[model samples]
Target: MAYPQELINEVLDYLDSGHSVREAERRFGVGHESAARWRRLRDGNLRANRPHPVKYPQDTVRLALGLAYGGHGFGLDEVAVMVGVSAPTISNWKRRYVEGGHMDIPEIDLGEIKHLSPDGRARMTDEELEEYIHKLELKAAVLEGTVKVLKAEGIDDLSNDEKAAIVDALPAGFTVTEALPEVGLSSSSYYYCKAKPERPDRYGRARAAIREEFALVGGKRGYRYIRQRLREREDPIVVSGKTVRRLMAEEGCRVSYAKKRRSYSSYAGEISAAPDNLVARDFHAEAPNEKWLTDITQFSIPAGKVYLSPVIDCFDGMPVAWSIGESPNAELANSMLEEACGQLADGEHPVCHSDRGCHYRWPGWIGICAERGIVRSMSRKGCSPDNSACEGFFGRLKNEFFYDRDWEGVTTEDFIGQLEQYMRYYRDERIKESLGWMSPMQYRKSLGLAA
Candidate 1:
């Protein structure tokens, strides 16, 4: 089928970028034949537009016919080579001349036989060519319409009403007669669906509310959280999670995340004594201040590299305290630990888990934890999953905030400020499905654990 020119160009550009046609088809959802044909056309192999050498003298055909009919054991294949025409042409001449009692071989316009038949035959008329291209364009129009309105790949098993809606949404230059069959709808069914009054959208209000919530968070929240917020809003949109998901998708409320990059490591050769893995990858906490996981992640911008160290509570994934600095030194870890320790209630000592990083192994970090009566725990040598909870937090943070952004001209301080702002948003505004669609701060307030 003839894909839209924009999609064709995109696929071609992808191919030109050193990717295979198969890769382009998979990536762009284009058919392999169409992509390969377009590639051929791009490479100056215009098979469709190229002219075939069909010009031959009338005498050459006459000679070829005589050789075929001669009783000298000459076959049609042997005779066709005597002249400059194909075996099929000689056969056509014999059928039209000898069998039909014609005086002479009827002249056929060889130019009209330029296109290859669908069964690999070399005989297709102008009318057949037009019909083939028209069918392709119709199929393409149907595909484009389905993607635009129905958000689907093909019209397989779609209800008549849905198919009719797709037909109605078809672009200009396409007719209902052409689109109806492609979508598997009868003309009468299409007309009947069109004549019926339009059904009211059940999720119209939900769509508007979802758009607002999506924009409020700058499209960082997913549908599950939005569904919860919809139910909790003053004018609640009480709908199922599936309905909310559909509405958000229909409204184009999506968060585009980025691929993960190699994380910045702080593992310097053992600078001080290391503690045992007390948390043991069990990040779940029964109460606040039971376990705290701390890790330092680096963010590189055009201005410079900025480091962030945060002590995340095992309960509700809340960042109890965080410190941002230009360097990931002992002070960065120490200050964050101190701030986190300041929030503990009387006789509350949480196990602060960290990786085997020099900052965490230093005496400064040890002294602060020892004086605060906070327990220290460390992952094994070069084992990150031992501190997987903090690693997970960093993964979420980078995916949601750091990546997918163009930080071309921002200063280090400004980047730090933005990072700090995102952390606040993460704790107070961003909803988590694990927390029943409430932020960490909101979850804390719900439990009367925090103001």
Candidate 2:
């Protein structure tokens, strides 16, 4: 099967994160051979995962150098890494300073002292050079300690411009070269970064629009939804989800996940009135309405708690009918059942299944089943797995919609409307792996099962 570039990229993300190609295929529900072909993934920059080299601030280098010179056991090459300079350059600098009191850097022939004599002080007797180098190294260690303390006290996650500003703000004793190494920037990057104006965020316009949309949705919409909204605007501006996510993260605008509430069950010890488990956990259906699962889940709103009962068809995991009310009563299930049964074609006898709830066992529900010629199947007492298909629908519903928002200040009526709308979206928009990434309605329509 052909997969979209986005889907393939998702698989690549999994692969890049230390997962094997087989694992990526299984995780993203892609084909085995597709993921195994490594060459295809590397062809496009966006399709494959690329390495991001590490970047550091210049002041940080000073801290590393100070530690090494203070007998931290770091070699000259290691010190160079800490300061973002070449190992040879670090060694040369140390030697030149040691041998000539910081003046020998230009005077001495650079190649003559490639071999080290410990400290690099000039013209001093070996004895003097040794004592002076020790003093200097100890001082560097002290400087590193001070730099660490200051960095910890400063703003974390500094922007590039802020880092440059910090370097520019350094005290008189610290030179630009010392600060440059700490930030881990080459002279070119430093100059380019310094020249750019810092007044506006590069993504300022997009960030503003994203923040507005996020606030409108009660800060509950995720990056995908926000990106969709941006694309659907009247004067649609092009943008990517990565930008939205980054902006949201920078602004501390995040959607909080709400835990799902335990579902209410009316499972009593098997009674004579309850029907047999006819479906027997056989959720697979040969055609539409062959197996139907129904269940009720409650939602808490400021106005009051609301209950939703839906009859989901097993063939395509679509909701045939649903009913919502403020009260979790027998009427809610009965109304839902009536609507679902009405959806069946003439002479169709769907096996309507439900948990051993009082609503399903009640005479009202039983009478409807008998009148409509619908076959009734009940789950074993307290065995949710028996009617797992219906439970799965409820789990997905709550996870995607009801469990991720603040219902506070939302009236029972408005909440019910949105809940109903979400169910419609779930059936018509949300894609499923089993359905080949098609929504329930889309899957059914694709097979000419419905218009």
Candidate 3:
């Protein structure tokens, strides 16, 4: 059934040894047809040696016969593997053999099968495949040129459905260069098909532009003033204060108060009465309310000159009591001292330190301190450092609170109310860098002091 190389060689050797076909078939697994084919090859070679006219070589015929015999019942793939050719080439040879009834050797030139039609001739000549490809290339170039011209004229705005219809209408397997240009597109149009749409209006562009203009003019005017100015001029857009504030932020503009000259004096006479460490040596205190510092500072509120006297503890710098009145007399200062004394424990003689202002010079004030066992300490006259704690407190109050506001609009009552809130916040919440960045209440708690 199957003739291996070894079997074919064995059959040939048996024939060469003068063995009969029947004997060779019995010795080798090869059939009688294989023995007859091998003998035909040997006889054809011997005839070629006589050299009358060797038109076709015996080896060529032998190769063809071998391929045909191997491909007898085998598939093209199997025949290709056996003969060392591609499966398609094997298929072509098999097709030629079936149609022409002979091996389609290169030496046999069958004068162009002209009886067949053009399509049939195409099927016959393998070289004709190149001509077909060249024609396709030419058609693609023409279509590509047409698309470029149409795109240049802006007449190629076809919808996706229309474009797809155009594409599907073309011949199948047509190159992109050929197909795209017919619809007035470049080869790149196939890839970048969709056009970019128009951009929509920016929502806050008008407001943003107005804000930028306001900032460019300098944001010294209030939002209401600016709005009034714009309206009086009959501007295109009306804007609210909130919108102006938003615009101001966008334009990096800030409205700040202008600084004024210091209007109050820190003069306090009669400081020669007290000795240096006897009445005012150590400023340190271990806990809140242990020692207190007091001073009078003046502020110009809308209600006219208001005197603010605040009592602060030396230990944690906590404000114990404060009062704002029209005068810096002894009554106002004593009232604030009395309120501060109320915070002290019974029989507690907390040292009270202050500059010898006219308030501390009054007998009623001294009597109150004497009754409360409060040691009254006066600072050296004209030396602010002697009462530096109170001076520092006043500086912070002005820097952080008073200077940032339009003071011309603030009343005494409003200032007092805001001061109360600030005092509470400062004592209970605000962290002090001196107290390890902890609040006064927190520092007191850490030192085991009662509220």
Candidate 4:
């Protein structure tokens, strides 16, 4: 079925704005193949595909209109019969030429004549064949050169500036118009990109500030955090978060970290009677030191295995205290808990939650909590998500720091020192999206809860 030209334009515009063709199908209620064809036609790359309705050449269209308007007063049906088209189609063409202006006429070429069948080329005169072969040579040259410019990706994946590079790289005699069709770029877009260097960069200062912020945090942040940091500056740089993301990609101010899951369980099977699940997967706390989650994660280095026991406050994901040692023993867990309790003021007894790990279930660990009036909470046997807030902290810690580093030949003591430094950095500097892109300490200061 024929769709209205206006509908086609609207769908193509939606596609040009960086949405996928499948999304356009659902949003515009158009068929997927039809929308994709419209996109290719708009990009001027309709080379191998046949036109759906067999579009007649512009010369034939002009001739048909000329005979209809020859002042013989022929009816629409007479013109239709002569041109071998329906009467309504003839009438529509006449209306489009007269009322809508001749410029609105659509010209659909059957691609370059060289792409036609052999018999189709035999019908052409020698001069026409020469012109077709000459055009083919130009297209071949452009395509060959553009391969280097595009690398392994398709031309449509490129930005306008990248496409214009193909146009600019054309041989001296070839014009930008000659190179555009090969690269699926329009003349207007090519010239617009050509003139871009003359225009002052609108995001110059903002790009510098974003890079500084991204580098300030060791490039582990996403764009939202970088944008929040920019806005928080004394002399703020107010820009869209999307703009920050694009600039980050363009300036190479992004981190690449691959995640690998490593599991280490301290569950020694019923060390003692576990406490009730007091937090019950609700990791939120209104005030600092109100709720605490603790867990032990083992990191295997070439030197040896290093274990970390951290007590994380549920309020803002702050690492309240952490102890790194060569072994995952009661000493590591006890020392971390002792340091965490030492920071609490009187009457601030937080619920200490943990998995059914023997370190937390042991008498020494319980005695410290009992002396400090800290309520103990425990997850059910072998359940990780029950104490997931603490598990999530370990996930982030390893993903951002441990997973990507090379720990070859480093002593356990040196590794512990480095881990200590990272703990300090994570607490004081690493921004969290849940805390409005502020570090744990920063968020506390913002709430007037810290010095």
Tens digits of per-residue lDDT, candidate 3, 1-451, equal 5667776777887776545576576666567777878778867842344313222234433343344454334454554554344666545544555345664433321234221235555575556766555655655654554475557546755554445445644555566565554444554555554332234434265455556555643444445444444443444445545555666566565655545665665455553355342335467887665688888888776677778888988887888888877777777788998898887887678778877577776778788988888887777766777878787788766655666557677777787787777777777876665686567888887877854
lDDT of 4 at 179: 68
Greater lDDT among 1 and 3 belongs to 1
Ranking by lDDT: 4, 1, 2, 3
lDDT of 1 by residue, 4-63 (tens): 899999998887654566667678998878888888888988566532332344455566
TM match of model 2 to true structure: 0.57
List the lowest-lDDT window of 10 residues for candidate 3: 107-116
What's the count of clashing pairs in each model shown? 0, 14, 0, 0
User: Cα RMSD (Å) between model 2 and the true structure?
Assistant: 9.6
Candidate 1 global CA lDDT score: 0.79
Model 2 residue 75 lDDT score: 80
* Candidate number achieving the greatest TM-score relative to the actual structure: 4
Candidate 2 achieves a global lDDT of: 0.72
Those runs of model 3 whose alpha carbons end farther than 4 Å from true positions after fitting are 1-262, 266-282
Worst 10 residues of 1 by lDDT: 113-122
Cα deviation at 335, candidate 4, in Å, is 3.0
Q: Among all windows of ten consecutive residues in candidate 4, which has the lowest summed lDDT? A: 106-115
Best by lDDT: 4
